[model samples]
Target: MTDYNAPLRDMRFVLHDVFQGPALWARLPALAERVDADTADAILEEAAKITGQLIAPLSRNGDEQGVRFEAGQISTPDGFRESWHTYREGGWVGLGGNPDYDGMGMPKMLGVLFEEMMYAADSSFSLYSALSAGSCLAIDAHASEALKAAYLPKLYSGQWAGTMCLTEPHAGTDLGLIRTRAEPQADGSYQISGSKIFITGGEQDLTENIVHLVLAKLPDAPAGAKGISLFLVPKFLPEADGSLGARNGAHCGSIEHKMGIKASATCVMNFDAATGFLVGEPNKGLAAMFTMMNYERLSIGIQGIGCAEASYQNAARYANERLQSRAASGAQAQQRIADPIIAHGDVRRMLLTMRSLTEGGRAFATYVGQQLDLARYAEDAGEREHAQRLVALLTPVAKAFFTDNGLESCVLGQQVFGGHGYIREWGQEQLVRDVRIAQIYEGTNGIQALDLLGRKVVADGGQGLAAFAAEIRAFAVDAPVHREALLEALVRLENTTRWLLAGVASDANLISATAVEYLHLFGLTAYAYMWARMAAVAQAKLAEDAEFCGAKLACAAFFFERILPRGLALEASVRAGSSSLYGMEAGQF
Candidate 1:
């Protein structure tokens, strides 16, 4: 891979110029004292340094070495443990954690850029801390004050790490079908007994202990998902004095030899009567877990962006450097025997697609981060509710669309390398492997699509869409460059949403059948809006910084003319309905 570099200028543009994140921070009372533009810039710079220098150097070695399982202990790849310690000391893990608990208290808008940098540097390395940050959010939001006091500081400080254990060998998507048992103890802690498979960071040697936020059904619990409860199960139980005590029942049976992210341990956790504390209320675990899951969903989406970005940097560099066939019209590099691949039209298409998707994804991820900050930190209840609604509607889309597009971007990057891309030497293949899991984990892309189509859109009768469309229209009025195109796209989205809502009542399978396309349609529109906002900023400031802003305007034009048209096609596919899907019987094949 071309030495991984963080797109700092692009990140700054999206955060400060496109979204005015610094100004937003100034407005939020909680962040007003904690963070400023300088703080964010310094953090981004520091992140770019360590991630590129320390973490990135280990990525290739990590994947090559992978994680080792001997007896019952799990050991990470070479350099990983040391790197974890370095990251821990820097207070990078809790960049977005609550300040009350020793976290840096950075907003998601800035935290996300750091996240992108880490993932870009090393997917496996980023995941270890990603889970820790996410679990801290869940604990801070739902756990009792006592529980938070016990775990929050250590987790935030990176003295300890965390994991979410929900999937079992028998259960993957359907939490309702999980057979894990949580038995109450006379001392108040429950005995968590179950086998949770595909548990990321379930077992690792980097930290003194591992905190697992588990989901299980109590004996007195009702049937189905609503009956489940959340529990805090640590590998090493803490003493009253706030130090490690006896080892808990959580154990890693074995680690998966996965397709990608080999350095990050994906374990099969066996919780054998582990001592656990209840979080939130009885039979209300799903809601608590969602606090972490939703956070992870967005983080995972950024994984896609990061992977695609790393791939693009290498691909773009290779395209400009490697000379093969002459240009279509004639030889551009007369000095060389043949022209560089970048001179070809097809090569330009691939490179531009990678740039457009990667950059647009960065913008989209930041926009979502803006909403998250508004929802959590806004003082006004109305603003908070509006932000929360947008979060609810957009979270799944962020997870699904970013990842799906992330994979495509990575593939295009690989394709740009041609035969060289297929080889491990180029590092493009590794990225392709690493990025594939983003689509499957946290929640599968299909599940996310269904959530968007069914829960967020249809369940509300498109009221959420209507609210969101109004906001888009309001922005479009100011973004004169792509105003009409954005407005037209918004109308198409509203009409398509109405179309989905129009038929859900009559067709039981409508959501499942067209959910993916519907989400892409929404995602395409979202990106178009994002590009329009970007283009608007780039348009007015052309003379101030022609290279950066001009490129933004050009890319926005490319997105509007080329990529945005896919929304119409997605709408058509959604309207195609479930009839074609149902006709294929199981035995017909």
Candidate 2:
């Protein structure tokens, strides 16, 4: 079984120590009254219990059983419906949704923590709920007040689930090419006709109704993305009493059987003149859809972190308990027959790398979450702008780096198990498979890099980079200890930022080609800064309690000494530019 205890401890450290999140939460009037340290801790404790006891046990089963499609219906793995029932009954679906619409109104910072736990427990099961929550966020942000009052409550209560329908047969990342049409009807509604592929939770047996926020073009609309519009298409029409009424024209033509996250029910949806309501303004669908897409990007990153946490726990347990070759130091004569693999330096190295990345990733996520919260709730205009810039700059990094590291960490965790890692029984391989999608979906890591380098870095005149560099500078200057190491990382980041700005204008391809490496370098440097800050906090806490704080400080040192050095390689790779990546011929593959 995967151990969630350590992960939860790390979460608390990130929340209380690294972020002092509760203190910030106290500043926002709406969130202040509802969430305090005690309440937040209680929520986290309950979340951990639900995740470990309920969700983790079902992970492998969900992956194995997958989703089944018969006729026009979709059925998830056995026990998933029951688990989802418990999940919704607990009001988890609305954990961070809008309070005005009957959601729990938890802060995104808190939601990030629970999301990490959810993903760690079972990413397959977590994805369905994530889609609903993400869709709710988008709707809450952009949908009309009537729509919010009508649909948000049901989505929050789990009476219904929500999905963002953007991908079509022809359009994945390029929404300008979408063929879906939404024509205005006499009743002031629209009739939607189109096919959407890879529509997760498009149609499922889990909820009473499915609410799809779709993107389509109006018949008279101009060509390309500017002509697009967003529409709300429900699986079933609503009755006067707000209950599900007649079935709509939308149906799941089929469900996809894929490499991982099988229980998610990726669907190919067919909307045949589906009755729909326009969301936001006409010809602004892409902007509206991005409200949800951005959140999903972060959620997917959490998925990666969750898988890495799971893999690390499983691998660590195996290493400690599974006796193998003798210690290299010849220190344990009593167990001379065989020593645990953990006694080997390489195994320890892998485990530490996993720990550093996982813990650091969570901290960075919370940091981003704090910025998101501030962007909405902060009283000062400058504060909000600062927060927004941070969100914009770090969002891509959080989405790409965390997910990529999640896969890397999980794969490394699997390798620590040797051949047993590849086998099905151990569940290590499942984690590797589950985390792979994070890198591919929610905008490929490559695209995320391009956005970071092109839009976030250069287009904004390096404002985002400047803000992030400022944050790093503040941390290095103010942090009680480990200041030098943090400063070192910041210095490296500053130099890289200058290089990116200088190169982007002269040779745009240079930025595009080297974007991924620069993003990684930036991510690793940022993570290193976070780890150093966390280590400083952990070190101070050690004076109060030795054992608890000691382990944390050790993990911090492990991150700086062993993991932070990877930034050097990332920096080197970025300096290499796109020459190697783009120069190859099409037939080279």
Q: Write the per-residue lDDT of candidate 2 for residues 462-568, one digit (tens) a residue.
A: 77887778777876777876678777877887787788778776775887778898889889888887887788888888888688789878888888887878888
lDDT of 1 by residue, 430-503 (tens): 99999999999999999999999899999989888888888898887767798888888888888888887889
Instruction: Give the runs in model 2 whose Cα sits over 4 Å from its true position.
Output: 1-6, 333-336, 582-589
Clash number for candidate 2: 0
Q: Candidate 1's error at 166, in angstroms? A: 0.1
RMSD of each: 0.9, 1.5
C-alpha lDDT of candidate 2 relative to the true structure: 0.87
Candidate No. with top TM-score: 1
User: Cα deviation of 25 in candidate 2 (Å)?
Assistant: 1.4
lDDT: worst 10-residue window of model 1: 473-482
